[model samples]
Target: MDLAWVRQHVRQAAAELGFGLVDQTKLVTAASELARNTLVHGGGGQVESTVLQNGLARGLRLTFTDEGPGIPDIERALSDGYTSGGGLGLGLGGARRLVHEFSLDSRPGAGTAVTVICWVAGPPRQRKEMR
Candidate 1:
């Protein structure tokens, strides 16, 4: 998959979905890290985005899934700067910091799935009537 295009698409989608500048930046950064992990470690994966609705509230959810060699130690993988390869190891941990909610599920030889959910910060409200 085209990582740059994926990141750009995420940025555009976030903007169109009414996420603020800071939120959009965070989403883009998270997408980058997740996409790289999917490519380098997971061998291949998919990223999906959906609009989230909680009653009168609205938000966005992003899921990244992979079917490659699973992580052997999730805790170590999540530790900052803990990479097996000689590469910077900020992908998963940094991603966790960038979202309101983050979850990961994986086991050795069982693949991995990462889900992140972030809301726009408030419920939608209609304008008050003018006197």
Candidate 2:
């Protein structure tokens, strides 16, 4: 249920930001993957979505966090094929590749948090002459 919500939320945001079809697809796909990892691996978590703008470029950001047993090996976790659960192990790495920015934080006993952002090139910003 929550994962679906996550995907929907991202989709709406992408649409609202005028993201192209490719951008929308990438953002939603990344969000779904990360949300699933947050639930199955992190033992359930929360996601925060936000919109960003920089010089006419728009972006959607999703942050997922959980209080479950944190990942013990960050290196292995982000590696090509690694899974703490019974899955294909492409969730994290693949999700990261789909987004423009990705960040993950976890401690031995604290928990885990993953943040990703997908950006679309909006109209170019105008440059003023220094004359």
Candidate 3:
């Protein structure tokens, strides 16, 4: 949907998953920046969020995809103080720092996709226990 909606949704999801206030704020901030980048630079895209489990850790993963022109220099894009747009240029790098896992894919004329994950350590549980 929109940036605000995305931010709110992400914050709620993080909270529901038992994230602390600081972690929740980090997720919301990251989601907002990426959502804005999708709408403004990517000309609109989709953001998908899901809960994840791996042994004793629980995590939240967010994937953003866009059909607009892809990034030509992913390295530069991820570097601090770099922006094709006239914004503050902390969107990508800052968001990456807020998450446990970060990935980005882009091809000049094709599109761009970004995935980020944040994990919280917990007691180990079986997969069935999650159900």
Assess every candidate by TM-score.
0.84, 0.86, 0.88
- Which 10 residues in a row give candidate 1 its minimum summed lDDT? 119-128
lDDT scores for all predictions? 0.81, 0.83, 0.85
Strongest candidate by TM-score: 3
Off by over 4 Å in 2: 85-89, 123-131
Model 2: clashing residue pairs? none
Task: Give the local distance difference test score of model 1.
Answer: 0.81
lDDT of 1 by residue, 1-131 (tens): 47897789888877766787898899888888888888788898898889887765567788989998898888988888776673335668878999899999998888899998877746443445799
Mark the regions of model 3 whose C-alpha exceeds 4 Å error after superposition. Answer: 86-89, 123-131
lDDT of 2 by residue, 19-120 (tens): 877878888888888888888878898999888888878888889999989988888778877766665456688888989999999997899999998887
**TM-score of model 2 vs. true structure:** 0.86
**Positional deviation of residue 20's Cα in model 2 after best superposition, in angstroms:** 1.3
Worst 10 residues of 3 by lDDT: 122-131
Error of 3 at 15 (Å): 0.3
lDDT at 111 for candidate 3? 87
Candidate 2: global Cα-lDDT? 0.83
